[model samples]
Target: MRILKTRQYELVEAKDIPDPFPPYAILSHMWLSPKEEITYQDFKSRKEDIENDVYKQTGWAKLKRYCDRAARDGWDWAWMDTCCIDKTNPADTQEAINAMFRWYQNASICYAYLGDVDAYGSLEEAGLIDQDHPMNEDLDEMPGMIPVPGAATNHMRTAVGRSLVNAKWFTRGWTLQELLAPRYLVFMDKSWHRIGTRESWAAEINEASRIEPKHLTTFKPTDFTSCSIAMRMSWASSRYTTVEEDETYSLLGLFGISLPLIYGEGRWRAFDRLQRELIMVYTDDSIFAWKLSETNQGFIRLQRQGQKPGLGILAPSIREFRDASQIQSFGYYGHKFEMSNLGLKTNARRWKCHNDHTKLLIRLNCGPEPKAHTGIMLRYAGEVFERIMDSELHDTRNFERSRDWIGVQEKEGKDIIIRAGNFRGPLTGPSIFTLRHPDEITVGLKYFMDFNVPLMSRKLELLDEVSLLGRLQLQRNELLLQPNQLMFANIELQTGEHQSRWNVLININENGFPSVGMASQEDRGKQLGDPMSEAKRKYENLAEDFHDQAQSEGCLPLIVETKQGISVNVHLFPRPPRERSSETTRDGEVYIEMREYTLKIIGKEKKDLNGSKQPQSSS
Candidate 1:
């Protein structure tokens, strides 16, 4: 990233710049960029003139909206030359140009305002000024500088002058190199084309070409008539542009291919203008070969790597009106109707005749023989049938717009009925229809099954309509099937209402809880068929085994135990819950009685029978 050392210069204010004269109206407002810097000396030099210029200061309000939007967007910042950079000094201007490449590289995006597409003036018109001006005599017929009141005379002959004039195509607010180097460029007007203004001027070359044809020459003023005729003939097969072709051609070189016709029309002209005239398209991968017509004959030939050559006829012509329409046919005396092979000088089967209005006839070679067939025919039915449907899938009386359906007949043997929004009229050629949800989906389902019903020859239409139907149906289903929502399925019994093409229900012979067949040993071995009961039994047994292990691990009780006291035939019965709690709390203190008992004997066993305590503590 090369940057110029910042010079120790005074910062100049934007108000100080000299204003352009009244006759020279600004086509586009200026902007400043963060990439540039300004100085005091620069501002002071232009301050007096800029302050006096009423138009620059007064009309600034018009730019407020644009400035506000740009600021909000963040992608674009103001980069107007007048406001953004200090251009008063020659050193500053030179430094700015040198730093342009780095500046553009750093920018996220470039906004190229083409201004008004129609507001452009020709180079000749830009030079025009009134003969009655006070300094008219002092100024040359061409572009030149005249004396200013408080500032040095600004001349158009300088290198900077050339840049200012040529810059309108790219560099005015930006240098040409800077404009080209940006990461991305957005044209403000969607329709603004970088191609040259006139169909002829656009054809000029901005870059060099590699494989330029040997016999090619530049275009002259005389090639218009033949080119137009050629274009009308081939218009059906190819997409050609009448606007100048050179700019696109020049930009192509950035991709990496080279165009060779960087030389002049004749061998005698200087090479400098020649380099600027012819188009050179080079790309990173593919190389396209081009051949220009000799003697300014208004034609170009383009050929891709593996395809047959194509011809591009240029408008504006010279003499020797050759038929630019179709490639010349074969034979020595002139074979206008038949195709001749210029490369092989023999008859070729690939060539076929085509007419603008007539149905296209194509002939192909098949296995050493030629087979002929008539293609599908789709003709307009001359009337459009329209209808509208409601949410209930019933028809509603709506405005019927008619459009010609091509060879289509509805159930009534009339033109296929198409229902859309407010339009109900005859439609032919190309027409678009907009429809709401259910109708769109219903139509899509119908078309998906039998699109041939709408036309003699089928071509798919209504993709957006089909997509809308899907979205609408999904939304409806979502609403219908909400959580805990109740819905009814219309079910019919087999013997009653279920006998139809779509649904079937069967009744079993043996009923009453649906008998689970029990298999006997004889039935199992003798092929009578084992019962499902056998499988269920095995499953239950396995489940019990698993449950036992699980219960033991989980501290679950699987057995009950009873303990007996045996000394001298004394027996005690279990106490109830209330009695046990009372006994456990007999001491007037809270206590928990153990559900399981642990034995500890301290009294004599004989006391139980006697109902009194004997001397023996235990038996």
Candidate 2:
């Protein structure tokens, strides 16, 4: 690393300096035009030119003041981006980008020169200030000096607050790390006058940037993990960089990630590289917790004719994470994610949307509440799943408070692929999905078959099949069933005392074929098929290789292609029979067959259907 020999204002490599590397002060500021700002080559070729210009009336004064301040603080070295490193050298650029955060952190003090703001002059002419004494006009005061007496500076603070809020330094992409990494920072105005220390003006800085004051006041390099990826990105949403690539490059240090500098890759490509880097090292699901801002909702509206969903699984920019705060990521046991050109392959449960069967929310392991979760919305498009950028997912209801929280004795989540819709590039579009599990049939389970009843034999239609599918979906979020694993729909029937309750169960039948059936319920609460533990030895030996009828995986979906471009699956299981009947031999009357059995009913979706009913997936 090369930094300036402060007193001489000459660049010196750290290896050229004495034994242990000396401490340095760093300068952070907004850059002027390329021609106006000095560069490293310029410093090497004409050392006296910098000194001559510094002594003259020019923009070089900022450089001079920065050096003078560091020298005053007993530091022989200072580093500024403008001239410390050769930007023309890719190696230097890479080193600088990677080490920026640490350099600021290691600095004993950071001088944040806000060339567009002031100390206390604007209000001095106004009656708001005490006219008894005028404040100093320049930053010649020593470190820690206050414009007004510390005890009597409310008006002075207000002036400083107004300036800090409007400072361009707060809006630059690079200055974000500068504000948080340094142990101590002093803000200087256009005239090089002190505005306030980072400690004193943290609130104003936070108010300006919408970042929490704690991030500014108490920060450690490792604190990045404490904040959600979305929260950290939120800090940069309103900030911008000169070169589009810098928008993502400037943020590399904050994430503890490194990548080769790609100056011409454009903003999207740079950001894409950054996200892919994070996915390699971080397991937090909050990385997927971004939504389209209201301003950019039309990002997908201009789709060309015949366009199938274009939004990728990853957002196009940090600006889209405007509202993602207060969300945290937690590990859901057995969860894993693998990234590929096909997109992110992960084993995570999903929730079929309540209002739209075609839309599903892949439950992220992060949420605003402890017991609940929010997911990225994806609309099923026949063969693939398209990501939804609609504002509804980000509104006040926390994704879907109306949805029930099911206690699932979850196994490893079904293996699924979240597809990046277009592999050409991120700027082109977003993503969709495909499932690696054998049965990724789109969400719905309707029609009950019973040969005993003629009309019902063909099919028993429910009042609302779509709603039932939604309710059924939660019980088995992912339709991927391991051999014999079943899917169940809990329906607590609301019929009167004599009401016969029925449940929809999909399980592998006696002959190892998928079967759907509705049977009378004997009791309340959701019931699933248990392995038939009573098959006799004769039955077990009947077909040596055959799966025993009693030990089938209950409710496993059986997807069959009912029509071109449309496939359907069904599931239901049997409940042991219980009959209420009586037979008496009356001498003069008829003899009814001896009484057998009866079943009492209870269902979860029975009442839900009483009001409204309807019906409505695979990889």
Candidate 3:
């Protein structure tokens, strides 16, 4: 480290100064244009020549004034970042970057210079008249000094306050640590006039930057770790650096961690590596709770296209940390966590979304009580990971008001596979659902297979007769349905004392799979000619019109069932298939076999006489 002799305005190495280091004040200011600011080589080559006219140039004049003030305060040495660290030497540059926070913390005092503010004029503009005012005529005043009357209010809305709040000093990444690390910080305007101290202007600073008051007024290195990771990152979110990578490098000292300086590795990669290192020691899940602003919703859409996986899992840039203030209210328990292939895995129970079978919810324990708060498990890279949706779980009703959850059951040795459809939420796109346990993490479709009387017999007979091709797979306690396959869902409905069973055939499309529904037995032919034939004809005509409109709009008409259990007339319209050469494509068009079946009732039992229903067949 290099220290400057205040009186001589010459730099001296700390080792050569004396046995004990001198108490020195540090200058904290924004860097000026390269041509105006003095560099290490420029100072070394023309030390005497530069010092002679240093007071004439604005940049150099501020340095001289800082040293003069430090000397007046009974300090022999002062440190200024501009010419103190040799930028030409990589080792010196890296060392200075890593040790900057500690240097500010250890300084006797810090002088924060705001070159844009005019202290005296701003005070007068704010109605705090100078000593020359009639009200202060009776009071004695020093020359070139502006004194405010004892009755004047502390209103800093004038030009000085605006300049102080909007100063370049507040926008730099390095200035953040400079402002917080110092024990005593004094704000001075352009003419070297005092504006206020850190304590006096802390509220203004907090309002301007959204930083907590405790951090600006009374900050310690330990406070960095004590605060949530997202909150810490928020401080630097709006700040920028000349070199992009320095944004992350500037924050190393705040977290008390260091990494080798790699300048060319863009800002995103630098911050990504920093976050990876942070998670190694930090145990807060809020670090992964970055919110996407309206501008970055494109990234979310891209995630749906499978063009970008894991991009939504982590924040794209540091600017997103602006939302970190909201995450602090979550009051999350500091649970130790590890990164799973899907997402983050912790010791938390998982539940499936009842409204949308594709969505999964993980119960996060916020406090000592087992009352768990829910967070959605988003899919990225074929794995389901958990992220806090709402900060405060005081009323889980905020999210639970629309959705529902079912407890997941894992077979003794087999992993639980939860097959859900595409997520229909606005924020999270289509995501796979998975449940993670202490011993293992499972990802796949697992459904409770409580087969009805007839379906159980069919499953046993099919197991012996036919090979389950890309259609279905039988597990110990669950069944997996493949895509583009039709399956029967049996549901039992009860109205008063009378019970009726209905069976519906559904086909899982290629877009979203892992579908589940319930069905049961029903005799449609017997209820066709009931007393409500006129109403039934009207309903059938509406269904036909809807089917015609769906074909015209190029959308598939969703199947709708009526409670009357009536067998409407069947109709079939065949569209000619276009022929194409196999050489035009590597994988030929998928030929889905169309099988038409008629439901036949025999002795109170209903069964398919032929095969499964097809899209072309209608009843």
Candidate 4:
């Protein structure tokens, strides 16, 4: 039976230990951890003392004990810088350094305990740290300054200056030729020790196996060779190496790993890096191993169980991985950020427009903002108003409208009349429009009628003719309502020498409706008129039925069914901020200065014609 020695756990005077151990004890146990907590600030402040204590108090025996247990637990391979060889003792350090290649050749695995295990795991999960690659890839790679790996080797060797074998000491024995040996490079987080709970490591190990079974392993005595199972264990370092060697080795082995290889010029592509990383998942035919280079900067490689180890490759950056994912949830550092739903960027903007009285048309420049979609709002203001006038305002206030099949049958020789059907009145004229602001009224008429109009209607025809006027002639809806075209009509009335002419064109204002269009009411009597009352009435009835059914069934009403309830209002009576000031700006500027608006349709219970119903709030 193997005699496993246990240390005598006894509290001793700080002065009983060596010079560095005394101070180290004071800093690590006394100042840093005084019964309650360990403050990083205090630890950093006493870093020197901490280092001294680490060097003095940490002996080879402790490391050797851990190594023996680790081996017994079926961890055939181990790589603790302190226990792997002697460092403080120069002769032993050199001897271990020379035999590193051979040591790894014989060992089945290598485990690196980076002080902060949870942090290491997080960095790896986030793709911030890397391992299993040479520390430095190129000297001329960094543009402004020399590129250096974030962490150094046990010998304090800079990543750039260290030879390939020494730089990749963590993965030294892994060669393409020695493919038969099942080698693993494991990273044990040091943070696990400082953590108060015991379940962290166990949870991590279990979760890795559960979620990523291919990446994790648990040790058991029965499992060996191609089917060997092993659980990593702790041991003392003294048996593995001398006191002086363990002391010096501990310091050099403290850092993580990195790679600096450049695959392409400019920037690396995400897909390419992903493909590379995926390929590296397979090591040998029977076995495979993976390691994080540094915290998150290394690449992974897999070889056949009996293959010779190849040179280490650099790990791709996180940015590259995200790009490679091609998923909508993958966001970049700048420009487009990923949204939660589809990985696509949510930077896309939307603007909607509607006219309370008639058809709203808008024109925009094609320069800076690319033109994506164009829409016209044929509102139901007239029908809504009718409902209000009939004392049925409550019924229509929270009404939902649906899309009605619209047709524009042209009446030959008849001019497109703006005030048609229910909207005709004595005072109002056929609303004409022009892209330009009216300097003088050329054509005019009298009559104003309020009624709902179809999206494609005589109203739009009249608007097209009015806007084209003397400059351009338009015959069909397709010709006049092109994307990004503006429409407004010129109304002129001459009274002696001083002429009075105002443009009373269809409110083809901006990207949205004017506030008045969405306002509940101008006064008690006045209400917004709908354009397509017949269609709107039908749609509203259907929507009401659907809404009623949804309410009964406990379901939310689909907003799409609530057609023209969405309307844009442009208040002409209340002077706008731009118009309030007598400043002559560009026509585009004036349109932009006008208050834009929209209506959020709301749903309510269907009103019974005979039932006593509560008054509905106007919105």
Candidate 5:
């Protein structure tokens, strides 16, 4: 560490100071533009000439004045960030960054200079023109005369206060630790006038920075460990750094951990490394409890293919840790833990849905609590398995709590193992069993399916134009193609055995398949009758037509070409109603309701030109 001798205004190495180092003050301020701030080389070469040249630059002038003030206050030295460290040396830069918090904490006092604020001018202008004063009652009637408030008291709502709140000093990432680490920090305006101390300005600072009052008032290095990782991350959310990697590097001291600084490692990798180091030193599940936004889902999908070590279910960026209160609610207590390949293992009980198919509900062993029985919805896509919550499965707020699904407690264990299902059908290495915090995992599996299906279909359209064109021809022949020219399945429901056909408009849902009868048509509005029987007949006819068309074209009609030129089978099925009813309408008029038809794109399958089955693509 290097300290500046206040009397001489020259940089002095810490080693040069005797075994018993003298007390020193520290300058905490935002850096000036590169051209104006003095560097280490400039200070070294022009040590004597600096005093004369420094006055031209605001930053150097402030530093000189800060040193002079410290000297007059009985301090031997002062440290300013702009010229104190030899930034050209990598080792020095790294060490300084790691030790910055400690330096601030050890300082006799910290002078926070706000260059934008004019302390004297603002205080005088506001203090002399108080509208609430009794003298101001007839001030409008008098010319060039106004009531003035006393200048003896300090008010935060004055012009000086506004300048202090909006200062750039409060928005820098490095300044966050600086603000918290110092024992006594004095806010000084452009004229070097003292505005307030940390204690006197705590409330205003907290309001401006959105930091918790306790953190601003009584901060310590230990405070980092006492709070949830999400809360700590939230404090840095609105703060910024000049170098992208410094956003993570600057927080090392606050987190009480340090790793070699790799400047080029981008923000994503830097944050990932930071979280990895944090998890190694602290066992807090809330560290991984980050809220997912709509944009974050895309990142999760990108990483779903293959995740890195120590990154199990962790969000890629700090932006996800937005809510500090939500993270603190978990109250996870543990210091040492490890992540296992198997997560939250449980025995699944099969339950029937309206479709008559069984869905698995995995019973989780949540610690020793007897009444805390929780079940997560288990879904399987080939060998990959996923765990979802009950809240994510359906809109259950209006319905009674059923045995179908339940929420899991986050304090169960560090590494919870979840069994995929009963049949150990072809285990694909180690299955990824992930269970995110309930508040963080808002969107269910249906959301991802909804978001990706259309993209997949569009990609398929681009990749397999030939197959899409063939499908288009079939749609055109049936007049099922919309006016927009998009290919869709036609649902022709036959009623009354007279072969009366009602043309049901098809809609492409988030699932990427054409569905019909979800919305009643104006022409069919008055015809109110159950159309399940007619829908069943229409499905059978469509299935027959599909098979015959496949046979004639020497290619499966169900097989659609993907963007990668892979053939995927599309299945048409009837969607079960929320509640089944057999009662016909009072007038006995038959009508088709929307949402009757459902479509799904299954796994890829290849078929030869001769209609013989061929090998499918791995993807």
Candidate 6:
């Protein structure tokens, strides 16, 4: 460990642990810009370099004032990062990073400097704070110095409280350990003036860092890595490091790992190594509980498991675990994961998704409760299992209470190795979709309409353009449906001698959203009375239906599954209304709506809609 002689500005090297070390103050802060900071090499040449008023700059001023503050408290030694370690030497840098947590832990006191915050807040009475004020003196000899003990009074708290809430010190990658490992810490503003001690400002720190008050104030070394890895990663999700690799490097001490540091490896690769290290050492399966943050797109919006892109078992970044800080881990003991050239292999319960063979859920051994387990969405790809994070088809708000289709059942224990690091072979996936619409309707006709059909991927076109089961008269229907799910148009079905007359109504609103709904023979009859009534209903534009179309009358989802079981889910987007006009017949009857006719034929692995091929859109 290296310490600075505060009184003489001399670097003192302590090669071995001093039996009874002198009390030393440590500085915990983000580094200034490159040109502003004083490095260890800068001090090796001359003792007079800091004199001649050359150390008046912000970076030098911070160090000088910190030393002054330590000396003011009657301590002769103080330590800081910027000028302490010789970073140019790789071995020295590595050892320093590995021991940083302990260095902070052993400190008698730590000064947390927030460069973006000010001790004096904006005064409403005056426009702005005057630059020339009794700020903390930059050197011990400077006049009009701020008081030392109990300096942050009620006026300082009122001024510094709001600024502390969003201090940049709380959002830096390395500060996480600095904030937790220190025995005693005090927050200092930009001018190095005392704001408050860590104990007195625990609430403000908790509000800023999302760390519990106890974690900030208590000296609990045993409790450091007891938290789940996912929870620890979440704390740094919103934080940033100047060099991205430091994101993983700074967290080494927090996880109790001492692997050699690779400064230039990309962030994800570093994180990948860290995760692999963690898996080898600990049984916390909470590492797998991350998902992308929530968004506006919700229920019924489906994307087939095959259509969505695949992910490795590991998350790409810490940000993916945004809301995972509070979750607890039950531990995945007894299930030892083995990593090989193939990938990570583990034996655990693999539950099949209801009615969907391609999709499965892997249990996570952590959640709010033991029985309340969370499952990550996984799909069986060409030769290996891949994770699914982009598709809403598998999205579940609460895994504990998700629907059967969204949840998993029928668990079978299997030892599977998901493809990851071994990427010499292709991470295989198929690019094919087949949509088939049945001409005949059955009692489970809604199932046909919602799944294994082309209804979901139908292309919109004028009714006069294509020919299908021709439009039929309503005869006598009297149901007045909402604008969202009104019976807009119809396609006649096979009316066999044994079968009752049945038809499927397709609703295409002005926003271009399509709904394939099947009403019962009785319900269909009560919709529109005659052909004239149908034309009138269509001519009316049914603008009222577009007002608040939450319930799509008999809206059934369209899931297109091919012969090979590759599914294609239609993302029905309600876009802005487009200008539309219909044709009027010679008999004084005008065309009311349009039906998108998408004809698809299954190819070897892919399919062609009609003679031409079509691709489905994603949400």
Per-residue alpha-carbon lDDT of candidate 1 for residues 1-619, written as tens digits (9 for 90 to 100): 1111112112223354234311111113223332232333324555554345332432232233334334444522344344445555555555444444445544554544444322112222445343343331212222333223455534332322332223334322122233334455433321222212111121111211111121012221113222221221121111111112222222222222233332223211211121222212111000101112232211111011112122211111211112222221111221111111211011112111122212111111111111221111111212321111111110111101112212111232321211111211111111111212111011111111111122243222212334543543322211111111111111111212222111000101111010001111222233212113334333223223333333344311211111211121111122232222122211001132322111111212344557664422312
Cand. 3 Cα-lDDT: 0.53
How big is the RMSD of model 2?
23.8
By the TM-score metric, which is better: model 1 or model 2?
A: 2
Cα misplacement distance, residue 52 of candidate 2 (Å): 4.5
lDDT digits (tens) for residues 1-619 of candidate 6: 7889898777877764265888889989988897788778777754576755466456777788888888987888888888788888888798899999989888898988888876554322233336565545332232212234555444434445677887888888999999888888887777766666787676677788777676666534334234667777788777888886787888887876787888867676787888788777777777777775332011112222113335667765666676777766766556556666666677655566667778877666676555566667778887678776543222233544555544333354657777553111111111111124343422121101112113344222223311222222111211112112323333232323433322334443323344543322333235433323443342223212322242354344344333342333332222232233322121001112333233221112134444354433221
Model 3, runs deviating above 4 Å = 54-57, 130-153, 156-160, 224-226, 310-312, 329-334, 340-344, 348-350, 362-377, 380-403, 407-619
Winner on lDDT between 1 and 4 is 4
TM-score of 5: 0.55
lDDT of each: 0.23, 0.58, 0.53, 0.24, 0.51, 0.57
Better of 4 and 6 by lDDT: 6
Off by over 4 Å in 6: 15-19, 51-53, 122-158, 218-226, 293-309, 332-336, 369-371, 390-411, 421-619
Residue 184's lDDT within candidate 4 is 43
Tens-place lDDT digits, model 5, residues 1-619: 8988998888887779766777889988888887788777778887667766534666677777888778876888888888889999999898899899999989989988878776555545767554453431221122222213444433434455667788888888888888888888887777666667766565568767767667765655544334556667777766777877888888887777888899877766777778767756765544544444333443334333223121234445555555443234123332233433453232222232333222434332221123332333444423333443211212222122554433333443223333221111111110011111112112111100111223333211212334433643322112221111122222222222422112222333222234322111112334322233334333333333332343344322343343333343434555454332322121101122223333433333244545575543221
Worst 10 residues of 5 by lDDT: 424-433
- RMSD (Cα, Å) for all candidates, in order, is 33.5, 23.8, 20.6, 30.6, 17.8, 17.4
| Residue lDDT tens for model 2, 80-107 | 8988889989988889899999999889
For candidate 4, what is the lDDT?
A: 0.24
Stretches of model 2 off by over 4 angstroms after superposition = 51-57, 128-153, 221-225, 304-306, 331-334, 353-357, 382-384, 392-413, 421-619
Error of 4 at 82 (Å): 20
TM-score of each: 0.20, 0.62, 0.58, 0.17, 0.55, 0.59
Write down the TM-score for model 6: 0.59
User: What C-alpha lDDT, on a 0 to 100 scale, does residue 74 get in candidate 5?
Assistant: 82
